[model samples]
Target: MKHENAKYLRPQHLSGLELVRDICCGNLEGGSVGSTEVTLTPGKIKAGNHTADPQTAGSVGLLLQVSLPCALYADGPSELCLKGGTNADMAPQIDYTIKVFKPIVEKFGVHFNCDLRMRGYYPKGGGEVVAKVSPVSELSPVNMTERGTISKIYGRSFVAGVLPYKLAKDMATTATRVIRREIKDLYINIHTLQEKDMACGSGNGIIIIAESSTGCIFAGSALGKKGVYPDKVGFEAAEMLLRNIRHNGCVDEFLQDQLILFMALANGISRIRTGPVTLHTKTAIHVAEQLTQAKFTVTKADDENASNDTYIIECQGVGVTNPHF
Candidate 1:
């Protein structure tokens, strides 16, 4: 007697199995992994040939929906191992790496029996992939100094992570332009957040060497979430220094305090007017007042507006044998 007609799997059933196998093997390219617009549709299968095991047959007709997480990396496609999934009220779990996808997997090969340390969780997604990246190259050394003459170097820094690249570049450019315009024969260097990691604020400093006839002044302005413009602040500071050098007048009171301290160290009597003092005639009157308590006798030039109204207060102190003519 011939055996009863054996059951044969149909084309449709074979196709369904192939589809599931393809997804499991990562054979299908869902979409651009980094694209925010891409989405994936789950596969479904219809009922077909049945076997004694209802479990395998029962799953044949059910639809399997696999939703993927959005890719966030901007660089190239990254290899990720899905840890596990959460089913509504189910607690989170991890997924073991069985096999890796091809091309990428072919190059990197498969990694089994590997431990994935979860540092943080991507909410809702059950599975997580950890990748080991290559180390970055070492940074080159940099040396900063004032060339020949004393230079006032000012630097303003912003958090690079917080600001866009273009905005940071623009801020640096604006600051340099303002500094060069205010100070003649001045050199300005502007660095970005990547260059300097100081907190977001502007700084102004001046440097003067005894050998150099002129002093160098610098002002740095920075862009912050909120505050005055750093470029303008730097400009104001440089301009203030320039005005002091040109007019021989006290543009900022801070300089007066510095002058007093500096001259005291040299044991040279220095006079800075507390009230409104011009570069014209009355500057001598101001210097005479400062010398009243001191032993040195103050003398003023008799000629009016002599040598651009520069009044030299001759301090006849013990160490100061010759007065500053």
Candidate 2:
């Protein structure tokens, strides 16, 4: 019902449960979640622009995550605009969500796009993000296990507000250096951005995206915090991406859970090989099972010839239909 992370990002006076209650049930006369028991009545969802302001520097990425499913089933196209932290600690970055996450969802026959109007960091929190989601009548099953060949590696480094452009460049340089050691012929390009008009205040970070010949794109990113060196941020981001690459997973660690809900909603069985199963993945499976009549199985492959044990997630979908039959 409540979590430490939720407590940190939510308004200090409002509990996470209370916030959800207010949003879903609407607060009448300042009544809290406990004031009344509201039953959710299902109906044909409307298509239009929906917006929210988290009030805290909460990750807009997370907000989008919860909204995506509902949007996908809307009677018509839906658009969402969220104002909050576009990039924050322990949350998915807008770049990764756009480049890596959305593409994976597309494989399930869901079409959507994310556009970041302005970057938002912590403290000042003034970022804006817009998402356009197209309704889907059905979802397709996926069976991805190969990572294919390394084709190109590129990155984007951004510094907002008062940060120097050199910080972004340095982070890209450091990250490229570490990644080059793994694949000598790999081409690493880094784009540096120093924008004075950051909607969400000041911050610096880098995101490295690896594109494979099979069209699978994986990403790793690091956000700049007080006292952290730019070079270190680059190195860490590079290392994270490299680790994911070495694992030979079709989907990166952070993406495994994100794909689960779609897989469970698909029309047929879906399977994928990924890195070690994370608690987040398990939790997603649990939630998916509860939401739909879907079944999930996780298996760990033990092969003496393989460097690391791989995780396999298999899902039998509930065949959820769009526009509600």
Candidate 3:
């Protein structure tokens, strides 16, 4: 299938390892996957209700992340019902996405409302989320050159099913202790939630969010695994947040890549100063450049006061307008 607009071209197809070989050899013809098929006809995106159930116990945050941008192109408001693991390992927790990730994108003019109907964990996947997305005519460029003082830090330490409530309390206490060493006057408020009613399975995790005076937010998290102690999880999350603050970057490490696409769509130039560039950030830059046919530049920070890992990314946006396909 093919979707074409002045801003981008989307070739929707299924592929496997063989498809990689074909692309490497410059063969443009498509390959097949399963019998599942889709037929596309040219038309404006219509407002409607959509349901997605990713049968696997994969992270619902991953599914929502991929689908949110597409929803913004709809001609009218869109409502989505998603089901899967709400707090699975190796993916951004749903709480972080809603509180941290969504707000960052909102700075660029994306509008959406989400509610977690039920919490899902690993091994048994039955989580439900509802999101309402509104279409936008255009996205604004974001200039986050400075991340001012860290005014406050807040977090949630939650446990569900069989875990003891003390686990969550201990996590909050441990994390607060670690953060106070760096910022003597810092206000760290960690809430503890131990609920047997909301979760689909047994799990515990902590999500920390740091708010800057300039409205930039940096978040860090740690999940509890089978053998990991609750205190260790709390300590790790605090350490991660401290590391990001020490680097003096505008956003946390993981968020740098997430903003690339929005930056490419904005009007005029968009610049971001961030910590060490990861492969994910590099890949996002490549993908944005390829899809929008725009230019992005990466430069290392030369200031003696800056950390060696500091880098600056600049991009010339295509000025994606409303009524985009």
Candidate 4:
């Protein structure tokens, strides 16, 4: 008698998973694991009021397993696996996996260790699997001023489909124009993914970051299908950075020249500029209010005649406050 080979093919990279991780983790500089497995089994399919009758009646099913590297999860492993009675619903399974992982990777500091043990087929079949998890250090804090060093801008917008490249470019141009002086050394990146349109536009999200003389700034924006103007997304992000700067009382000719120093202190400081004020000026009372919840000191200039002419802000939790928590 002759035996047949099972033909075990290796799993390929899942772009969906990578995209989710990138969106969540901000930058791909954090710690990660490699070559984790994911297994799936088949389950009964309901037909209207009752379970669907099997045509053959004999055991009929399929199994699926995938292997991929851990992209995010600085603290421990995050599980990625099939759900919803994993029968033939590949699309739903994938969607659930993306939803579960996206927010987890973005909000928390955990790693992933996926494992696929058994496989299942359609028409009432089932199996079991496991995913290992571990923890790593939290990602480094990021700021917004880093945009000064960027050169090119990349923009990606996901509506029902990919928005026109021209539209994305227009948004990028607007962003640059709004903050031209603030973002020269940074590169802008934009991409649109259909996966983001999965359900009532709940999956839609935007991310913005900049690399400056100091370091990097990571920011993100998300929108549902039924709310807000999409065109304002990038502009809003730019404004947020501006507000953060103004709220911090760090907007001054001197501070701008010495951005590296302030950038280093951004994680430690809370309040920034009130608008586009300069350094060495009396800090604004608003700065005190804003930094009240942060970790930096709020400083203001006492003399109204000083040539520095900078606004004042506060840093609520410098050296002691940890944004990660």
Model 3's TM-score against the true structure? 0.85
Every candidate's lDDT: 0.28, 0.78, 0.77, 0.32
In the range 1-325, model 4's lDDT, one tens digit per residue, is: 1112243222112222232333243322221224234222222211111111122111111111211122222223344332212212221122223222322232223344434333222332232233444433332222322123333333343332233334444445455555556655555555654432222212233434332233323232323233445557557645544443333322322233222222222334433332344443234323423433333333444433222433434442322222223
Task: For residue 91, give model 3's deviation from the true position in Å.
Answer: 1.0
| Deviating ranges (above 4 Å) for candidate 1 | 1-171, 182-187, 194-231, 248-253, 265-325
TM-scores, one per candidate: 0.29, 0.88, 0.85, 0.32
By lDDT rank, best first, the candidates go: 2, 3, 4, 1
Q: Give the poorly placed runs of model 4, Cα more than 4 Å off.
A: 1-133, 136-155, 161-173, 181-187, 192-205, 220-227, 245-325
Order by TM-score, highest first: 2, 3, 4, 1
Kindly report which residue pairs in candidate 1 clash with one another. Answer: 83-95, 83-127, 83-128, 84-127, 221-230, 222-230
* C-alpha positional error of residue 18 in candidate 4 after TM-score superposition, expressed in Å: 27
- By the lDDT metric, which is better: model 1 or model 3? 3
Per-residue CA lDDT of candidate 1, range 105-219, in tens? Answer: 1121112232343211212222223332221111111111111333444443333323345544555565556556755565555445541232122222111111112322221
Candidate number with the higher TM-score (3 or 4):
3
- lDDT of predicted model 2: 0.78
Candidate with maximal lDDT: 2
lDDT of 3 by residue, 174-198 (tens): 8999999988897789999996777
